[model samples]
Target: MIKGIYETHIQVSNLEDAIQFYTQVLGLTIGQLDEARRIAFLYMPGGNKTSMLGLWEQTHDLQTRHFAFHCDKDFILHGATEFLQQNNRHPYNFLNDRSSQPMVFCWMPALAIYFDDPDGNQLEFLALLGGESRADLGVLSYADWLRHTTTA
Candidate 1:
């Protein structure tokens, strides 16, 4: 019955910093702001104000959270990675592996690149490459995934 994710809320240290990171780095659009409550809503691509990520101000002991934006195109993932790197953001692979580039989760056959926000929130841009259900294949490096997909 659930069709798609509409929204998610996460706490941030400062709303302004969060806004800068999300808007400038991640390229998400702002929807609404509750300055009194110290909260802001960031709308994702194709959101049209429907899909949102709420950022509530929280300073004390903020634990890093993970969230991903589903990229509609493979180039968007790679382009985002480049854009982030140019902005002094370091993209990470599984296990915080910066040495390796963005990887492919063979389980979903999706390409993913991960990075952190100003408040250390782990964020990702994921692009689904195919509609193959093969979780048993596990995660693969970008090159490996490409080779396997091409061969199979």
Candidate 2:
């Protein structure tokens, strides 16, 4: 049985760029990097969390994927802004500079602002401290799987 998410893997175009982005911009600590520089691991010391990402040279482009982080809205928003300020790069849609109106999922309890890696893989900083009804959603309580659809 699954307990919790352990780590994640993502492919990047350049190893040094990825390392600089994750460590310098995002403030994630570099746990390890292989001798060949094709694989690297990152960690967020504040959250006791760890994730791995890998990149290798290829002739053709690779499929893009996203990574999301859950935290307080203000923390992630500020983090995104700080990242932009330090790296001298704007958000994919300028979320870091907009103080007038939120263009994305800010109104929702789960705040998700997306940016792209050097390879164009979508990445997100998500916040869940705002407003979601985590109250009375029904879920399966049985030990066994639902074998038949019961109308009654």
Candidate 3:
């Protein structure tokens, strides 16, 4: 049976720059590198071998991709948002709205903040809210989500 996502690959124009982004900015650990083949492997935080991200240098134009890292704590997500902002990086919503705040996904009861890498790959930090499943409350803006969660 399938357990969970193990790894994913994406194309990059440059390996060294991509390495810096994934490692320094996104906080992934360097796993392996093949300078000859222009391939780089990145591991998620906490040294989890199960999840990996592969960056392959390609000369051809590659389509941008979107991915998310699931987090379990609200503070971490919030802190990530702040960190990104402090670095002059902006965060956006699923709608591609750059509002500098986290969005509330009522369907998943999750709070998420979205941003993009240098290659324009959309990345997210998300956490489930309330610690339980609930009704689908639909997508909401950061302010609205805060109000709803507090008053619900």
Tell me, by lDDT, which candidate is best.
1
Give lDDT: candidate 2, residue 117. 70
Runs of candidate 1 with Cα error greater than 4 angstroms are none
Off by over 4 Å in 3: 131-136, 142-152
lDDT of 2 by residue, 49-123 (tens): 654444543336767787776556566545665665557654543244544121333233354555677777777
Is 2 or 3 the stronger prediction by lDDT?
Answer: 3
Candidate 1 has a TM-score of 0.88
C-alpha lDDT score of every prediction, in listed order: 0.80, 0.56, 0.79
**Residue 116 CA error for candidate 3 (Å)?**
0.7
Q: For each candidate, what TM-score against the reference? A: 0.88, 0.64, 0.84
6 Cα displacement, candidate 1 (Å) = 0.5
State the weakest 10-residue window (summed lDDT) of model 3: 128-137
Q: Which stretches in model 2 have alpha-carbon errors above 4 Å?
A: 47-50, 54-59, 76-79, 92-108, 134-152
How many clashes in candidate 3?
0
* Per-candidate count of clashing residue pairs (backbone under 3 Å): 0, 0, 0
